[model samples]
Target: MTNEQFIERLQQPNWSVSCKTEQQVDLVLQACRTAGISSDKREEIIKVLRLPIDIGFSKYFDTIEYAHNGAFKFLELENITSWFFDAIKKE
Candidate 1:
């Protein structure tokens, strides 16, 4: 999907579309490309997303791993989109 369509999807109050991990990753990569996110930053974001979460420390860490695999399961589309925005803003 185009970046506009992707952003529109995120804007929905109850967007519940589910995708496979690979598909979700691909969509984020495509969105980054469409947004002109630099290669290094894109790779950094992808690396962060792909990192394994340590279940033992889920209660302590505020990192994406904790958010994604923690009790809250907060790695939904909106959250991922927010991460992408944050990645873009990072130096």
Candidate 2:
């Protein structure tokens, strides 16, 4: 789905599970850990991404993973700002 569509879906939470989606979430989480983003930073990224907070933080990772499934690549401090802007863009 497009970023706009993903943002729209994020407004309403859902609980359906997909194995691939879970894997993607895990991938992102692991990347963050490897990059030393810190737990607080990870949580903040989730918040910045506008993911669901009702679910535990672990589960919150899934929101952005599913929303940007095929889009995320290697993340670094230098590129993260632009990446976040791109991910949250309305159009």
Instruction: Give lDDT for model 1.
Output: 0.38
**How many steric overlaps does candidate 1 have?**
0
- List ranges where model 1 is wrong by over 4 Å: 1-20, 41-91
lDDT of 1 by residue, 1-91 (tens): 4547655544333212222365555554454445443255434554455433211112233222222343344523223444444543452
Query: In model 1, what are the clashing residue pairs, if there are any?
Result: none
Over the stretch 1-91, how does candidate 2's per-residue lDDT look in tens digits? 4754543433332222122233334434543444333265544554455332212112334333323332223321122333323444534
Q: Candidate 1, 83: how far from true, in Å? A: 14
Q: What is the TM-score of each candidate against the true structure?
A: 0.31, 0.25
In angstroms, what RMSD does candidate 1 have relative to the true structure? 10.4
